[model samples]
Target: MLRAELAGVFRRRRTLGLLAGLAGLPVIAGLALYFSGSSHGHGPVFLDQVTHNGVFLALVGLVVSGQLFLPLAVSVVAGDSIAGEAAVGTLRYILTRPVRRRRLLVSKLVAIVAFAVVAALVVAASGLVTGAVLFPLGRVTTLSGFTIGLPQGVARIAAAAAVVGLSMAGLAAVGLFVSTLTEAPMGAMAATAAVFIVSLVMEGIPQLSILEPYLMTTHWMAFTDLFRVPISWTGIERDLGTQAVWGLLAGLAAWARFGTSDVTS
Candidate 1:
């Protein structure tokens, strides 16, 4: 069932477009850096620096993408999972097959998560590949002014990527929850994007210091801490914990909403 759901998602034209766009970003970044001469004096000018220094750039891209693009991508797949079928009058057909609503929702959630992971990887891989092809490949300098040898640098890069991938899960779950609230795909996507934008704005307010810990965007850049020479795990752990809590709560909300949702049009 999960396999079939995934197949259905990939069959969509929107999914194909997303894949292409995701893959092309890295190539574009690589070319830009290559021509810009940013790697002129850098050591081991592989894509890592692009990946490292590019973290801020990537975060901005992802945040903007998440605001509308990623959520819409997620909604395009999950938003219609149940409601679309209900709208098309196929809910009755699906229910006649002995599939539990819970099982179906779970499958759809799994597929949404899988897609989010692939989307993030596409972004990360694009940056890394672009860096390798255009920049010098070797040791990378840390944001804290310390240098990391190639081996350690690679490991840190991997860690950063993993953190990035996990961060998107929270947003995916939020989109999934919103998906259950509306039959209009646009509504679901817009609601999810609005939540992200609001969170981002809240994260930026200095007076919201007490509320900062609760905002998901606050930890979105937690991976930046990994780029430090000594690699501070403090921010990474806090960010991971915050994301986990948010993801879990959002997932539970989605499950509850979907389980009780009526298919009546």
Candidate 2:
């Protein structure tokens, strides 16, 4: 069942398009930066470093898409997990099989999580290739003012991608829950996207500092810590912990709702 679910998820044109679009992000960014040129201490978080070390493009692309694009993609896929099937009137038939509701939900969630990880890795891989072709490849300077060899730098980029990818699992769970609540995929997608956007906005407000720690987006940029000289895991751990808690709650809620809910199309 899990294998079939994964195959179905990846075989869709929509999934292919999403992955292609994600891959383009780093390529476009690298091309623009290569042509226009960037200086040290200029632009966004990793833009400056991208020119000096091609691998930084992986980080830059992740940062660029972290805010909105990646979330939207995750939301769309997750939102469609159940709702899209229902919208097309196949969910009811799927439920007619011997598959238990809990198992089906689990399969959908796993597929969504897989897509999320692939999405992040696509960006990183694309960035790495594009950056390597367009810029110089060499050692990477840690955010803490220390240098590391290219191999370690690449490994860190891969690690950062994994962190970013796993971070979406929590949102994937939320989106899956939302998908169960409605048959309209667009509605689920929009609501899920709004949740992330609202969390991001609220996290930015000083008055919400007390609530910030609980927000899903609070620790998104924590991947930057991976680039530090000593590689601080505090922020990354907090982010993963936050994501786990959220995913757990949402997954439970989804199981509770989906387990007993009636299927109609």
Candidate whose lDDT is highest: 2
Candidate 1 lDDT over 118-207, as tens digits, reads 776666656555555555555667778777776676566556656765666666667777777767766676677677778889877899
Each candidate's root-mean-square deviation in Å?
4.5, 1.1
Question: How high is the lDDT of residue 109 in model 1?
Answer: 71
Best by TM-score: 2
Q: lDDT per prediction? A: 0.66, 0.91
Worst 10 residues of 2 by lDDT: 35-44
lDDT score of residue 251 within candidate 1: 79
What lDDT score goes with residue 72 in model 1?
50
CA lDDT for candidate 1: 0.66
Total clashing pairs in model 1 = 11
For model 2, the stretches where C-alpha displacement exceeds 4 angstroms are none
Candidate 1 local lDDT, residue 106: 72
In candidate 2, which residue pairs get closer than 3 Å at backbone N, Cα or C atoms, i.e. clash? none
